[model samples]
Target: MTARRADRAGRALAQGLALALALAVVSPACAAEADPANDYPTEARADYVFACMAANGQTREALHKCACSQDVLATILPYDKYVEAETVLSMRQGVGLTANVFRNAARFDDVVADLRRAQAEAEIRCF
Candidate 1:
């Protein structure tokens, strides 16, 4: 059951990424909006969608909600800052000195707070 669930998650992730990439490519406005602050790459958006959907569940409705959530996140956060915050979060999961840097930093906390707020807003608006 666990293996089947993992496989399903993987397939859903791939489909979400493909859909996000296709949307980014086909939409000129998305490319045009790739400026200094709001420049979320198609890959980044897709990654966000994949992760969100995985957390929410692998249903079709979850995919749509995750996509909407990412759209809200992209509107709220710049690509560079979002990357920085996400990197801090990812690194904080480890048990080494590097992880300590992420885990003990107020800046990291602030960024995460911002992300959480954005996510909350997204949930309200999308879900």
Candidate 2:
């Protein structure tokens, strides 16, 4: 009977340790999810870094600077605003009446301006 009691205690300890380990693994992820300011998805950040590296050069220093730049921009601009600016810029690059609307619209210009301001801030902070 003593041996059986010892085995049950050991099993209980093991279960407690397993629960602790699971909490340790999940807590940081939960904290990150709760952070509202860091709403940019990993893929968006990666895409920005890749484009920045392409434009600035593919060196390790460029990679660091680009990542920093993206972080700064994330702080300065929300992901939805970033998407809006990118869409405007993309539409402006096309050769048609629709592109002209994007190019000439004041709201579109404001969106691009916000992105440019964010980029400028990022450049100052990161590069």
Candidate 3:
């Protein structure tokens, strides 16, 4: 009876450890999924921060504010939509007929407007 009791205890301990290991493996993936802003690539966030710092001034305060702004923007806008707006803006900068198309389209205007709204929100929140 004592030997059987010891065997049961060992089995229980093994089960507990397995459960803990499974949770450890799954927790980070679950967290990443829960966060809407996790879809933004690190490089993209860094680029925004760099541009923001350039505009605001290259100081520690600027770094913090710019990083916060990027986070705020990410929370407000999905990465795909952000990319679409940026592409439209870039096309609008070209000095030709192709640029005119981007500049004149109502569809493009809506896309850029969404980005501008997100940027305004970010600026208000961070700066």
Candidate 4:
């Protein structure tokens, strides 16, 4: 009877471990489906946070604020558009006649404008 009880306990532990492994595998897929920024890769989010903290000032508070800002941006803008706008902004800031194209392109300006509006909203909502 004691041996049988031990065997049952071992089976219970194995079942529990299997359940945990299943949850660990499935939970992220469920979470990704629920998350709005599912299309934004982890590196993109990290880059945004790093840039935001740099602009806002590096501090503990800045970390939360930057994360909040990125979340707000991700909520408002799709990742593709966000990338396009960031690219425009980066090119516009370049120092050369070649950069003039990015600086002067009306479409790029519009994209950057949209990003600015989103950033402003994020500032109000997050910061």
Clashes of 4: 0
lDDT per residue for candidate 4 within 1-127, as digits (tens), equals: 6999999999999999999999999988888789866777889999989999999899989999999988888889999999999888888788899799999879888999899999999999988
Q: Model 2 over residues 53-127: C-alpha lDDT tens digits?
A: 999999999999999999899888988999999999999999989999998899898999999999999999999
Q: How accurate is candidate 4 locally (lDDT)?
A: 0.90
Query: For candidate 2, what is the TM-score?
Result: 0.78
Residues 1-127 of candidate 3: C-alpha lDDT, one tens digit per residue = 6999999999999999999999999986787699988778889999999999999999999999999999999999999999999999999999999999999999999999999999999999999
User: How much lDDT does each candidate structure score?
Assistant: 0.85, 0.93, 0.95, 0.90
Candidate 1 residue lDDT tens string, 93-124: 99989999889989899998888888899999
Candidate 4, superposed: residue stretches over 4 Å from native: 93-98
* Candidate 1 ranges beyond 4 A from true positions: 1-38
Off by over 4 Å in 3: 1-29
Q: lDDT of model 4 at residue 79?
A: 92
lDDT of 3 at 78: 98
Candidate 3's displacement at residue 122, Å, is 0.7
Q: Compared to the true structure, candidate 1 yields what TM-score?
A: 0.69
Best-to-worst order by TM-score is: 2, 4, 3, 1
Q: What's the TM-score of every candidate structure?
A: 0.69, 0.78, 0.77, 0.77
Cα-based lDDT at residue 61, candidate 1 = 98
1 versus 2: better lDDT goes to: 2
